[model samples]
Target: MAVVDVALAGRSYRVRVGAGLLDVAHCEAHAFIEPYGMRSIPIVADANAKRLLGERLQASFRSAGHAIDWYEVTPGEGSKSWAELERLTDWLLTRGITRSDHVFALGGGVVGDLVGFACAILKRGCGFVQLPTTLLAQVDSSVGGKTAINASAGKNLIGAFHQPSLVLADTSCLATLPPREMRAGLAEVFKYGLLGDAEFFARVDESSEAILACDDGVLETTIAHCVGMKARIVAEDERETKDARALLNLGHTFGHALEAETGFGDRLLHGEAVALGMVLAARFSARRDLISLADAENVADALARAGLPTEISALGLDCDGAALADHMRHDKKAGGGTIPFILLRKLGEAYVARDVSLADVAAFMDEQLQAH
Candidate 1:
């Protein structure tokens, strides 16, 4: 129902957000899918998404005379690996996928990242479309050009800057998501408000219940707003050459470490880790007098009310601050021994903080660990 454009000259694309957008036409599918004029479409999805949306999507595309060659991976962050990438590419090659064809990634962030990266390196470079099924993917990762697979050293350390040819965020697909996954997606939605719009945060705070319930209007507006903001930043600094796009990694520096420590499993979903990380970042900001304690508590409360973790201690991991901070040292944001954290100045005002000492981060994590 709404479109957000990421104008980057040659690489420009649009993010379409709406309920049942997978079947939408005129502005999107008509141009992208119709022009291919092929009977088959190459699609990659996680097991869960493929099971849930595969039949419906296949039927829709088939009705348009386009058959889908479905490729599936096990659904999880673990699928973002070298082995999976190699397996996926080999499958594509066996199927005769070429640079002239468009690949469709039809799942959450994991599927999007994996397929996007595969497309980026497949035959040097190929175009891909993102049919993101999760809220986290729709509002964040699906829009950004950051395609990656996890490395042994850390998460997202190996990848490329391949942008999607188109992003179709069908809110209808979200209806099949479990409560935990839905709540996790809400964390990224919350991040959009936290990082930019004070009024949006207030609206989200007031409408948390309705939003979680997936009211169509709320979902559309919420995802569209976040996508629009990201479109602006991606257009301004597509490669993160400046600090403009860096602000998008609001809690990622802390969150990625949590992900690495947990072995990137169901123990902590990426969005849940981001929820905890945002709280940590907020609390750390408050400790530095960058923001008030009240504001930080508000951030924690918002995420907690959405059924997300707000404290590292709650996970009961057998690790300490030193251990967690050590994992952070592998974060891509760090440079020359300094880790640049996305910290808040206030509710809706985030900045990159390069002055944070790892020792202090460890101490803070220690305090959090000991608190509960």
Candidate 2:
């Protein structure tokens, strides 16, 4: 087991990475909630996750002398809506949940994002534990303090920066994940390599099979390495004030736009959208001569090899480059007239650039769609 510390001044917490940590007699969750002096806990889980690891977590927390209440949201991207948040909060209040209580988000990115944001605004603010079940959530969303909910305007338009008290990433939970979901998660794993650590990206190239196979050792190493990378970056810049943390959004700008254009529904999972977004970012960088054409090809190849979507047209999306670019303008990262995009200089090196003209982005996207 490896423990990575997310140093955030007075609110620092540890991310414990290991296999079977969830079944180890309150190993991870206890260490996190005990410090908060919380006795009552409300667990917000997705239906699929509840069918898988929810019982074990509930049993462990109950056995640890904490009163437990559970809430299950339907599994999918649609669950991150204001209506769902309101319903869950009402459920909690009916159960007599107070600000002193904590919430345990026990699912993938959607569950973590919605539940974390719910806890953030519930009675002002409350502690929450991130027991990220999916690979995407474990390595990315679970570690970052950015919690959000989707609105009529766009995805993640309404949210807060509420940090989790602890993050428990049990590799075992990924065993039952569908192949598509596993592939979706690989996008974030690739993002870590693209954003920083060229060496890590190389390792991912070599270990893509072992990772997708859910090999315990490889999975453990990959999750801890990514967590450590994010922990260091987030500790230094919690609110993304500096560009330090924006690197984490290497493919997110384009990714979020695709999600919004697609209605933020099951048509595209967040990770899948990011997978395509990364390839587009790489291609756009190449178009600008920031990187070579080979770099763009390499990114596309890596994502395709990992079984993730590498082209927008391949997703069966009916939208065009102009429509997609229109969604980008509404992005929270958009400022003054340009959307800040994290583009790669090469694998493992990413930087935010606000100078990218929307016309060029649309043209590049059109080229990819035509090629597909």
Candidate 3:
């Protein structure tokens, strides 16, 4: 088992990453949840996750003499809406969840985000535990306190910074994840390396096959490394006060725009969008003479080899560059009417470019849209 501590001032927490950490026979898993000390614990999961792993998870908790009050939400980005938030908050209120009691979020990013936001506002903020079942959640979203839902303006536009009390990333649950989701999750896994760690990026580039195959050792090590990197960044910039935390959004600026264009649904998973977004960021960096064209191509090749779309042309969108760049104008990172781009200085080095012109981004999008 590997443990990474997110040392936020006066609000620190632990992210435990390992296989079978949520299994019934895992004594450590039991010990971790046992401390919450609730007889009837409230857990929120997506309908798909509940159907797949809910029985096993419930059994694990039941053995310890606890009953689970499970609440199920539809899977996907749509659940992160005002209506769903209202429903979840109402349910938590009916369960009599106090700030001291922890609500277990037992699914992927959607569940984690929705539940975390609900807990944040419930009775002036309550505690919650993240039992992330998806690879994306375990590696990135689950560790950060950036809980949010999409709004009419942009993705994660309506949200809060409420950290979880504990995050138990049981890699075993990933075994049940669909292949597409697993691939989508890889985009985030690679982002950690592309942002700060060149050595880690090299590892992913070399072992992309082993990772896609779910080699146990590779998977565990990869997840722990990503979590550790994220934990450190979150601890350093808990509220995005500095550029450090924003660095974590390496591919998000463009990725979120793609999501909005695709209607934030099954058409383009968040991670898949990020994969293409990162490729675009790399290529755009090269265009600005920040990095070599070979390096940008290498980034695109790595992701494309892993079955992610690296070209905007592949999306078959009906819109053009100006249309796509229009979506970015509403990005949450935009300030004073200027949208910042997370461009690559080189492979494994990303920086925020607040001075980027939206017109330049539009021209770049036009070029990518026509790329072969």
TM-score (all chains, Cα) for each model: 0.97, 0.95, 0.96
Would you list the C-alpha lDDT of every candidate in the order shown? 0.88, 0.84, 0.87
Candidate 3 regions off by >4 Å?
Answer: 24-39
Question: What lDDT tens digits, residue by residue, belong to model 3 across residues 1-372?
Answer: 888899988888888888877764224445445655755778899898889888888888888787789999999999999999999999989877777788889899999999999999999999888989898999999887999988987799999999998888888888888889999999999999999998899898788788778776888899999999988888888888778889988888888889998999999999999999899899889999999999999999889888988988989988888888998888877778777788888788888888888899899999888889
Q: Pick the candidate with the highest lDDT.
A: 1
Q: Roughly what TM-score does model 2 have, to 2 decimal places?
A: 0.95
The per-residue C-alpha lDDT of model 3 at residue 276 equals 90
What is the lDDT, from 0 to 100, of the residue 256 in candidate 1? 86
Q: What is candidate 1's CA lDDT for residue 32?
A: 60
Candidate 1, residue 250: CA error in Å? 0.9
lDDT of 3 at 102: 81
Higher-ranked by TM-score: 2 or 3:
3
lDDT digits (tens) for residues 186-258 of candidate 2 = 8899888888988888788789899989998999999999999999999888998889998898888889888
What is candidate 1's lDDT per residue for 1-372, written digit by digit as tens? 888889998989988889877765323665566656764677898999988888878777877787778888899988999999999999888877778778889999999999999999999998889999998999999997899999899999999999988998998888889989989988888888898888898887788788778888988988999899999999999888889899988888889888888899999999999989899999999999999999899999888777788988878879999999999988887778898999999999998888999999999999998885
